[model samples]
Target chain A: MNITGLETLVFGVEDLAACRQYLLDYGLHAAADDPNRLLALDGSGVELYPADDASLPSAPNGCQLRLAVMGVADEATLQAIAEELGKDREVHRVDGRLQSVDDAGFAIAFQVSRRQPLPLIGEISNAPGSPIQRVPNQLGVVAGREAIQPRALSHLVYFVPDLAKAERFYVERLGFRVTDRFDGVGPFIQPAGSLEHHTHFLIGAPAFMHGVEHFTFHFGGPTEVIQNGSRFVKAGYQAFWGPGRHIFGSNWFWYFNSPFGCHVEMDADMDLHDNTWRPRLAPLGADASQAFLLRRRDNWMPGPGTPENGDYAN
Target chain B: MPKSPTVPNCHAQPLCHLSELGEGSARGFLPDEDGQDRIFIVCHEGRLHAWRNACPHLAGAPMAWKRDAYLSPDGRQVMCHAHGARFEPDSGLCVHGPCLGQRLESVALHISTSGQVSLADPHLTCSV
Candidate 1:
C-alpha cells in the first residue's frame, strides 16, 4: 500500500466566504468556486467545504482526511493498488479516482498523479551581523504587508489513540515505513516515495476527536515565516504559535489560526532522508523536541548597553 | 458600606497601588481623563510597561481570561495562551506564532521608590 504524495486536503470550515478569504489572504489561488465547495490552489489544490455539507466526507475536530495519490510508474501500478485495496475494503470510483476508507477511519483516495510544481522562492542567506543572521531569508523585504506565497504542501499531522494499530495498518497494509519514532510515544511514518521525515504522522493518545493537527507548506526561509506571519497579524488573523524551530523536522515554522479548528503553518528547509538514514528513537519531551523556544521581546527599545537613553527620538 | 461608582476615575488620584497585578501580568483600568479603558502594568523583568489590553488580532481583548496571559516558559516572551502568540517583552514585537513582527502597544510607566505605579504618556505629561 505505497502512497506517493499528498493529493488533496479536505476541511470542514464554518464560513465558506471567510475561510475562502483567509486562504486568499494567505496567498492561495482560488481555482474553483461554488456555493457549497471551493478548490483553492497553491502550487497544489486544497478542497474546502462547509461543516454540515453532506456531499463531502466528514472528519472530527483536529483530524485530517488526506488523499495520498500513488505515483504509478505505469498504468499497471494504479491497477495493482485498486486490485489490492478492493480485496479488503469497498473501493469506490469517483471522478476517475479510487477512494476507500482505511481501518483508522481516514478517507483515503488514490489516483495516478495530480500534483503540480509550486512557485517556491529561491534560496537566500544573510550576511554577517545582519538582524536575521542565523535564519534564512525567504520572505525578503515583504514582511508586514504582502502575503508570502506558499511553495508546496509539506506535511499533515494526526493524533490517534492507538499508535500500534495505526502503525500496523499503514506499514503492513499500505507499505509505509517507520522513518523515526519517539521511543514508546509514536512513529513518524513515511510513504515509499516520500523523502520527508514523515508525510503522515500518527500520535498516541486516548479515544479522542480525530482531525488535522496542522498542515504546512515549504517557504523559502525563516524570513518568509516572519514576513508572512506579520502580514497575517496586520490582516487581523490570530497567530497560534511559532516562527520557532522544531527539532523533529528541523524546519523553521510559523502557525496561524485557521477557521478549520486547526492551524496552517509556513515551514522551510525541512530535513530530508533516504532509506540509508537510520531512524532515531527518543522520548517525546519538550527539550528533546525543540532546540530552543524564544519569548516575545520588546523591539521598541535598544539593547541594555546602547548609548542612547531609553528615549526614542521621533 | 456602599461601593463607589462602578466607574472609578483613576486620574483624579495621582497614582494607585495595584498589588493584584503580579510580575509580568496586566490588568485594565478605567480611563484617567477621557473615560477610555487603559491597561495597568507590570513585567517579568521588573521593568514597568503598560498599553491598551486589546490585542490587535481580531480586536480580541488579551488577558481578559486570567491564566491565559503570561510569559512563555523562557520568561523572555509574552505568551497569549488562547492562541500561543509569543511577543518579545522588551520590544513588544511578536517573534513567533501568528503575529510575527507585529508589536503590542507600549505604554510608558514610572515606578517610584515607594512602589507607586504611575502612567506617564509623554504627550499628556508634556501638556500638564
Candidate 2:
C-alpha cells in the first residue's frame, strides 16, 4: 500500500484520433503515432496513453485502470513492497514496473519513479489591480503570453462503489495520508512522497461509474492556466470546468472534457505542505469545499465604456 | 399527472421558491423530460440562468449531490462541483475547468416587471 508516486495514466478512449488531437493541442508532447496505441508526455515524463488498442491491459467494459508508480528509496523499499503485497496479491513485473491490483480492482502499477524536474517559472505575480493579473508586467508591456507547460502529473480521481474499501486499501496499505475528508462521503489522500493535498480522490457511488473521473498536471501560474486553456479551446476541444482556484489544493485549474470519457485538467501554483499540516475532517455538508459556489456565466467581454477600452471579445 | 413540456424543470420536485435562492446562492433544477430527468435551470445572482445541467466532462451532471453546484467566494464564477470546473455567470462560458471555451445551453429568460420568471423562447424545445 505504500505508493511512491504517480507513474502514468492509461485511458480507454473510444476515439483515438480525437483524443490524440486533444492532448496534442492541450500541450502534451506526442510520443507515438499509431491511432489505436498513442502515448503523450508532459515535461515530467508522465505518460498519457490512449488504450484503444486491444493489446493494452484493461478491465471489463465498466471498469477503469489506474497505474500509480511507487518510489522505492532503493531495492529495500521495493523488497518491502514485494514482501507485503506479494503475501496476498500477485505482483508481476512488466516494463520494469511492478504491476498489481488492489482489493478494489484498479489495475495498479509501481516502479522506480520516472519523473524529471519540470522547468517552471517560480513565483509569478502581477502589478496591483492590473489588467494582466497573475502575470508579470514589465514596463507597462505584458510579457508575451506563455504556454502552460505541465510540470508534473498531479493526481487522478475515480468514482467507486465502496468508498470505505477504497479508502482502506489506499490509506492502510499505500502509506497515503488523508489531507481532507468529507465524512461519510470520501477522502482526499496523498502519497507519502508527494506534498500535493491529494494525489488520488475517491468519490462514493453505488456502482463503478463510467471510468476515470479526471486527471491533472501542475502548471506555474494562473496566466498559464488561462492561456493554455484558451489555446486548447480555440483548437476545438470541449472544456468541462475551471480556470478557478480550488480551496483544497489552492491551484488555478482549467479542465477539458476529453474523448476518453473523463476530464483533463491544467493546474498551476498548488499549495504544498508537509506532514505537519493537519488533515481536516469535515462533515459532508452543503458548503464542505468552497465557501460558496457560482453558477456559470458567459460575459467575458467588459461592457461598453469600461476602463481602457479593454474589450477582449472582438 | 403528466408534466408540462414548456414549464421549467428542476431536479427536486416543484421548483425551489425564488426566495430560497439567496443573493448569490444558485440551485440546479432537473425537470422530468420525457421520463428522463434533466438539469434545466440555475437560479443565482438574482437571475435565472438555465442550462442543460450536464457537465461537458463525461456528460456527468455538474453537481455532486443536491444543491452542491459550484459558486466562487466572490459570487462571480459558478463552478462545477464535480471536477472543479468554472463558468462565467452572465455568458455561461466555460471559463475554467474541463469545458474551457465551451458554454452551457443558455436558456433565455423573460422576467416580468412584477418578478415572475419564465422562458424567453417558449417555443424553443429543450433538446440539449
Candidate 3:
C-alpha cells in the first residue's frame, strides 16, 4: 500500500496532433518510441491514445482519463496492491506493471517510481529590512532564461459519484491517508509513501459526470509557477483559473483549459503532512478557498501625472 | 449610498482617456498602490459601466480569461472565465454559475466633458 506518487497520466483524446502539440507547449518531451505518449522534461510520463483505441480500458464514470498510473516504493507495494485488489476483482499486468480498477471504476496501474530527487534551486527574493536572498544588482527574476519545466506530476483531482465508496477504495485498500476534508464534498488523500498533503483529491459530483476535474504538476516555487503561467498565456492558451494561492494545500496555482476536456495546472509550494498531523474539516466556500489571489497583467507604476510628484496636483 | 474609506478615492486620479478604449470594448486599470487591486470600464452599446475586476466567487479571480476579454462571444454579458458566470453589463449581476445571486462590486466612475474617465470615489473600499 506504500504507493509513491503519480508517474503518468493516460488520456484518450479525440485529436492526437492537437493534444501532442499542446503537451509540447506544456514543456513535456515527446517519446521517440511512441509519438502519442510524452514524458515530462524531467521524465514523468504522459501517454495519449486515440479516443477509439481498443487497448484503452472502459471508463466507469464516463471520465476522459482512461488510466492514472502511479509509482510504488518497491515490488512489495506492487504485490500488496495486486493481492488486495485481487481479493475482489481480477488483476491484470501490462508492460510488467500491475493494473487494477478502483471501486469507482477508475483504472490505476502500479510500478516502481521513475521520479528522481530533484536538486533544489531556491527562488531569490528581496524585502526591506530583511536579508536579501539575491545579491544587490543580481536580478531575482530572469524572464526567458530557461523554459519553465515541470519537475513532476504533483496531483490529480477527480469528481466522483459516491464520495464514500471512492474514499473507501483509496483509503482502506490503497492505504491513503486523509489530510483534510470538507463536509459533503470529499477528502484530500495522500499516499502512505508520500509526504505531500494530497496526491488525490476526490470531489462529489453527479453520477454521470464523474471524471477528472484537473491535474497539476509541481514547479520549483511560486516564481516558476508565475513565469511558466505567463509564458503559457503568451502562447495563446486560455487561462482557466488561478495564478492564485490556495488555502487548502497552500500552493500557488495557475490552471489552464486544455484539449483533454479538463484543466491542466502548474502548482508550487504545497504543504507537507505526516501521520502526526490531524486532518482538518471545514465548510467549503469561496472565502475558504484562497487566502490571496492575483491576475497576470502588466505591471502598474505611478504614471507621469500622479499627485505623488505634485506635477498634476489640482 | 455613502462611500467607504477603504475604497480608494479615484476622483483625483484619472485612469485613461476615453479615446484610448474603442466603443463596445473594455480596458483594465491597476491602482497605484500594490497593483493587486484592479478595475475595468466597459463601453457597451453606447453606455459606459465600470466595476472592480474581481469575481464574486473568488476574490482575486479576474473576469477575463485573456487580457481584456471581459465580454462573452456574443458581447452581451460580462463573463467570469473561471467558471462561466455571466454578469449583466449595466448591473454587474451574476446570471449563472455557482455564484448565482452574487454581484460584482461596481465602482462609481465619472466621465468628464473632455472625454476622460476616472474613479469617482477612490477612497471607497469594497470587501475582497
Best by TM-score: 3
**Which pairs clash in the backbone of model 3?**
B6-B125, B7-B123, B7-B124, B7-B125, B8-B122, B8-B123, B9-B122, B9-B123, B10-B122
Give stretches of model 2 more than 4 Å off. A32-54, A64-72, A126-146, A283-286, A291-314, B1-128
Native A-B interface contacts kept, per candidate = 0.02, 0.03, 0.05
Cα distance off (Å), candidate 1, residue A276 = 0.9
Score chain A of model 2 by TM-score against the reference chain A.
Answer: 0.80
Q: In model 1 chain A, which range of ten residues has the least summed lDDT?
A: A305-314
Count of clashing residue pairs in every prediction: 24, 46, 9
DockQ (C-alpha based) per candidate is 0.04, 0.05, 0.08
Query: Which runs of model 1 end up more than 4 angstroms from their true locations?
Result: A32-42, A60-74, A118-121, A126-146, A295-314, B1-128
Which digits, one per residue and each the tens of the lDDT, describe model 2 over residues B34-74? 11124445555566676666657546554321233345434
Alpha-carbon interface RMSD for all candidates, in angstroms: 13.3, 14.3, 8.4
TM-score of only chain B in every candidate structure: 0.60, 0.61, 0.77
Writing each residue's lDDT as its tens digit, candidate 1 over A219-259 gives 77777766676666556565555667878778787776565
What is residue A123's positional error in candidate 3, in angstroms?
A: 2.5
lDDT score, candidate 2:
0.59
| TM-score for each predicted model, relative to the true structure | 0.64, 0.64, 0.70
